[model samples]
Target chain A: MSTTEPDNVALNGPVVGRYRVIPLIEKGATAGMRPAVASKDVQEALALPGTLVADWQDKAIKRLGQLVKQRRGLRVFLDNCTKCGACTDKCHYFLGTRDPKNMPVARQDLIRSVYRRYFTLAGRLFPWLVGARTLNKALLQDWYTYFHQCSQCRRCTVFCPKGIDTSEVTMAGREILASIGLGQQYSQEIITKVKSIGNNLGMKPRALADVLENLEEDILDDTGVPVRLPLDDSRADVLLVTPSADFFAEPHVDGLIGYAKVLHQAGVRWTFSSQASEAANFALFTGQHDHMRDIALRIRNAAVDLAVSRIVIGECGHAWRVAYSYLDALVGPLDFLDPAHSRVEHICEVTHQLLTQGRITLDPQRNAGKVITYHDSCNVARGASMGQRAGGQFRIPRELLAASVPRVVEMSADTTKQKTFCCGGGGGLLTDDMMAVRIKGALPRAQALQSVVDSDEVTHLVAICAICKTQLSSVLPHYGLQHVQVTSLHHLVGDALVL
Target chain B: MLGYLLTAAFVWAVAGSAYRLIVWARTPSTLPMPLTPAPTSRVGVVGRLLLELLTFRALARADRTTWLASLAFHYGLLLILIMHLRFVWSQLPPSLVPFIGLSGWATLMLIIGLSVLLIRRIVIDRLRYISSPSDYLHIILLLTLAASGTAMKRLWPVDLYGVSQFLQGALRFSWQPLPESLVLVVHLSLVLLLLFVFPISKLLHGIGIVFSPTLNQRDAVSAQTRVLSGSSHSKTRE
Candidate 1:
């Protein structure tokens, strides 16, 4: 017998290296499911010692156990469910989808079942006792698809007897998935761009300069105003951070146009920083808290560098949420800006007040529609809790909508003032990849709109957030809604300008 | 000697648990939901309380398995508390022991039910996900207390005189020697650990969850009713 054996084991066939096929760590495989590769880069980053590939496997297994344990903790609630449906009537998705899976309780059970099996001692020991199957490739894919369906609306939590935040569970799941290097590609890419370039759209200094130049051109063409859109405008009276979409997209860009026109008309000194122009922070959507911190840091730094007083966040939903909810705590207690004086006003608020004070005039005649409904973005209206200083309380937008549009019909289940419906776009579902779900998810609003659309004969849907404008505009057509252009609450004011 | 050590440990644990309970009780309950108009009542206070009890919906609604784990663990713990109250009653006037006994049996049954749930956590895969070392310890401590209490009552009755003396001494900070009963010692010791660890761990969630501000914020149904005051400060003076 030869003393030396061939290097090839032919275990499964050469997938891991030249001679060895790494057996799938997970038990079954579906078609197109790629084998887990232990990249040298990954190995270097993880700092794996020796050729112990099993080390990574073991750590993942341990983390899986921890994840499972957390999931199991969630199970106690499932088994005890009274199913009073308190949370049922509360979900916008369920109300929209009419799909039971969209129901908060029903949606929770999907992840809950998996948790029961892997973590609970009964599930682990009995295997068949509770319905937990080992998390393999198929299950992981399911987690990816369905988990993304949650928009983290926080509505269900209100009805929950115990304040169980499903959003937290969704976030934890996403983070766990990320740890395994199985992050949602688009979301991860957005986070990465935000990390490196200061914006999710990857508009760095040069790209932002180009965008400003283009925006100025459009501004000159449309309004004939030689507006100076400054970047990092030092010693400015105010620094405005508009959502990146305002520079590029329609109706939203019009919001920016309205902003410039309002600023110019009021003779208020303000500047836009090229570096921190984006108000829409996708990090909130991805549940990447650190990245959110980084983005907030950059915005704060830009404000400080520009020596501006107030930070006027242009119409964006979650951006306002981040600013109002976490900005102070994260950047905070600045000596230059009094906590009370750090005026973080929504554009609708600023313009609305200015209008009411006779600083800005609106036509209200231009928006002479039979019916106009204002859709409150979840983040803007409902993100903060009551009693907090930054709760904002949805006063400004409501006032603006009431004033700017005629026949302001309320959505059947509209959470406008306080309990506004999510645009189904928050948490970064505004992009096209999640388009189907986004369109389908818009059904709740559409169904609510149906009664008003028919009875009230609504023609225009007003929104303040850029993402809402993009998502609702793209989605409204699918629901047989036409001529109901999704315009910003600002657009209504701008177009109907009595100026 | 071991009995004295167990008793000392039990005292330490109870003191710790009481401290935690106070902290948890005082923490505020504010949820971060959008400012919707609050429902007049979720069918009123009595109806709401019933819903919380029957559904445990708040906890269950967070995620399912956690709800089950928590409910089982909680109901079980509740029963254990009732049984312990019986011990407190034995020292009370004779009339109270009968009242405590009636409640104790009901609680005993609850403990047995919860123990089944506790055991299930280990055996079930799903429960294990959220289960931590502390979780297992909690269940074990609870189970031990329940079992030991049951064993003392049935299999090995503790000397009433010794126990009474010990209780009196423990309460007064006097040195009346404790009676030696293994079950009593285990029961008492586990109770102590549960207390000391309460504030620092997820167990505090029991109190924290009830008052979580995120749940209490009125849902955003109506926008703010007030009109914009004015824009005197619109100019953002540098």
Candidate 2:
């Protein structure tokens, strides 16, 4: 079984035969993967009120026991792993960091060991024999270091015969850590921002309106079309819930433009809610259900206040998963919305429906200058479904892209669809301090992408998720593929949309 | 004494397994997390479990070597277990008699499968890194059970009629005299230990598979309506 190798020799690290052994470090000193301690403000925002330095070990153990019973995935996954090691080489972090702790089962053992010590008879009687350990400051620190290293992508689950999802384990670990106030600053800070300002980036209503208005002007200047980016229009037919990054970031902004053009051509009345402008839910990354629910309810309120018949989510992977799989449970029935369409639909599904119905027209020639390939976002591919089919998540975006682009290519089979690799900055590890880990974690996807680029001269790599656009664009230059552009699926659609 | 000890071990195994099952059942599955490409119907889920049990589907997709070894070990164990039914039955079923001879091959396959797994765990760097003392102990325990059982059959033959009479008498609530063979005693003791440990060890994976939400739940997302508990009273204005 030959695996695709990254084009950049340095990305391969120190290779012995077929395996890469990046020396395991006790801590993340070299990769700078350590997150700052959650500030008191962030902790309070998450409703996890406690002192960071307090002796909360007993409390944490009790909380974990409660969580294991509450979350079935956690309980079953912890008990199910046979340490078969089928998932040992499956994690991108393990491949990149060469850290044994990064291996999915080992990463899981950090929590499972403690679960055994507290919850299982064998663990209580013979801890060392079963590899169980007591909960202590050292174990907690290991939990913080290793859990954050995971992207919670669920790749390991697909390969695990027992169907053990390390993402569930990672989420449970994060939840337990947060209960003791040992939260990751990146995700916790974002949750705080989303709570106070209705978005991860903390952009206020005024700034959001200005950004949208400016984008409308840019569309007119570039395409000679008077496209409108409406905001908070109560009578609109669709409520556009998008990530705040789309209003500010480079390639993400272009994807936003693409969505606008598609809706404009389809003649659908859509508006962005400044109050609930953000779609990225950082709370899910931390496994904070209350925080996630509070964040999702804002969108429900936006949809209700606007009297929008339908709600359409923007290009964000994990956010889409929360919207598709969790929103209904968190703040739904959503019974008042249009029954003709899904209560919450992905932008790709909306565009695909429009193209299929001939509600919108696209000129493939407009996107003929570049050969494009789609990178299936981890959460969307493995976590959520689109349309009415099982794999609509994988097919819907590609269908829309193929409709708008003259040529489309696929990366290696091993790295696409359910086996898709993370862009390495997901699950709230996108902070600048974690760049080394991010770059290393992204090697597999980069190598797979690099293979296609070398063979097919694929000029553009498009993704539906905002984080993928940001992460890949940043990491591409590091692998000497600086010229290969990373764009959004909607970016190409917007480029080809005909008025 | 052996009969009483064996009965006690069976009771412990059954009670422990039932306790584990109750705990698993009590755990709340707050979310539906079926891995996508999963079946959306109850019938489909059954089919998925069947495929998983018969083929070790996911492991096969992951690594062929481990899958082959595991398939041999599990199926070999199953056949060996079925062959044990002959001792409990006074009249062996005609259909099953033809396959009695295959028990020798089954034992060999079990040992070979276990050796492959043990070797991989010891030799493979990645596997060795994740393995604990208990992991190695599991394989060794099974190997000893297989070796002792096989030796009693071929190397040091036991009193089959005496063993059958004792087993039948126990089932009938009539305690008969035990078979006076050292090899038989060792084999029976090993079997008793395995049963006691089954529910407490990683062997619980046998039961865990049936309850795993990712593998067993139906992916009927649209069909099921989730009733949101609390109303959204506080609204953030745009």
Candidate 3:
């Protein structure tokens, strides 16, 4: 729909190539590339269009009606957007892909147009005039292609005049897609694993226990002290819920080690619960409240069973948002716990607090070799809070970096803090199937990161979100920043923690 | 007959707006999803909204150019509307009497704002690409109305006393002769068109922003848990 069709040169160039500006696409460049959803996964999740319902069009419309009737923000977001384009260039995907539909307003219009044609008075009367479109196979295909392209980063929301969050709109879009059994395989599979196995990786209690024990042994071998990674200990004071990736994946696992060392240093009795091993809730990515609630209940159940006074989440971006913002609301009345402390906390906040009170000594000299910069995770920056203060989410991580790292560098002003760009791997687009868009969507972040690398020989890029770490690790290499090591904020904390 | 038509248009605008708002209010947000770094108190929420309304705070941060032009347009319209209150109210506070002298300038400010917005829409790639036929229509409609109003002020001045008497009479069910000027007729007709489309078109954004959950929800103890239901549809269903 954009009048400015992208030049063919930009379209053919490598995603990492230096460009004066990313151009907007004409059409069909991305329309054919849709994330596939397995029918079996749909059936298992009990989401709609499970191959049993051949009439996906009706099921989709019915789901849309349910969302419009239920979500207050969705109703306003759908009905009110004046298409001001305040958020047009704001989305990382739009900047990367140059797909006009990736522009927040145009993306919302994908569903907004359909919603209008079926639901609104003007749309029903003058569909073309109001830019309303009747739902069809081709449009449904566009839903998958473009909606998945969005990382649900909410960078656009910070600048929107109406405060319409494109993440919220994309969530609703994904939810509607899920309803008709057309959900993305990456997120749907993760939700299935989480629903059945308690973690996104589907790691069982025994394997998780083995992983923690191995980490403890490794920590003990590295340092003479007996640092512990307690597994499912009922007597622990804090129930630490972290992403399953921390148990296996590099850098993430290091962040997990950082949490263990911090908890150990503070002498706070904390343990990981096998039953609620993952903090990154894929339900959020899929945008189903019921699914999110049912999945999140495992965390509460784990806390109740362990009888922990507090729940501290490790470095996972969307998980932090789900916990810090949505946890108490999703499954609440956490009255059994102590009233003085918040029910859920970020590991960075815990470390920051300990650093503030001098409970733990951090030797920033330990990280002397690296020039560091911190990347604010989308969900944490825009969707959640970390400490008692208002902008603590932004402050706490940087404060930790300041306390624990010797030399720190700031990125360009507009691209950090509330204006931070997405790492292009969040909102469940972390799958290999979505690699093209992930690399493309990462253009803004790469540009921002590439700037600091040139200006100040920044060697290390630290992030607090798991998806950001993983996404950046894979995508940054394309931009010739393979030398810029993307590690966790807690991994930095873990490195700088003194015996 | 014109008075009755105007009354019907106003009623349509009001009722349609109320229906939309009621539907929005009735829909539960299910979770506290305030864009973070938000106000923690109800009073703080009010303060945030006030800042946004009075200054277009979010717009200002997002795009400075649009923000300045929008401010010129909206505040100018506010001033003009205040001056126009004389037609509906027999008299206003004497302090406002001083501002009435500036209505012509206010109208000029509105035209200036509308013109810039229109030019930006045409010139900017991102805006032009995302813009639809309806967006241009909305601008053209407002620009035409503003042009007509400006014409009435300088080039084709209307019978002000008669127009006021007619509007005032229409409100109280008393008949007054319609003002006999083409510019005034065009301006009045455009006003009616705007009001009629207020609830139907993107013009509803004025009301829509008030109910936007991102703008209105509180971050303080974000666990307003009792309202968050997993299957709200089951509970809401008749």
Tens digits of per-residue lDDT, candidate 3, B47-93, equal 88888778888888888889989998888888988988877787778
Instruction: Tell how far residue A202 is off in model 3, in angstroms.
Output: 1.1
**Candidate 2 stretches greater than 4 Å from native:** A1-32, B169-173, B222-238
Ranking by lDDT: 2, 3, 1
Query: Ten residues in a row with the worst lDDT in model 1 chain A?
Result: A18-27
For candidate 3, what is the lDDT? 0.81
Q: Is candidate 1 or candidate 2 better by DockQ?
A: 2
lDDT of each: 0.58, 0.83, 0.81
| lDDT (tens digit, per residue) of candidate 2 on A172-225 | 888888888788778889888988899989899998889888989999999999
Clashes (candidate 2): 0
The DockQ values of the predictions, listed in order, are 0.12, 0.43, 0.38
Could you tell me the TM-score of candidate 2?
0.94
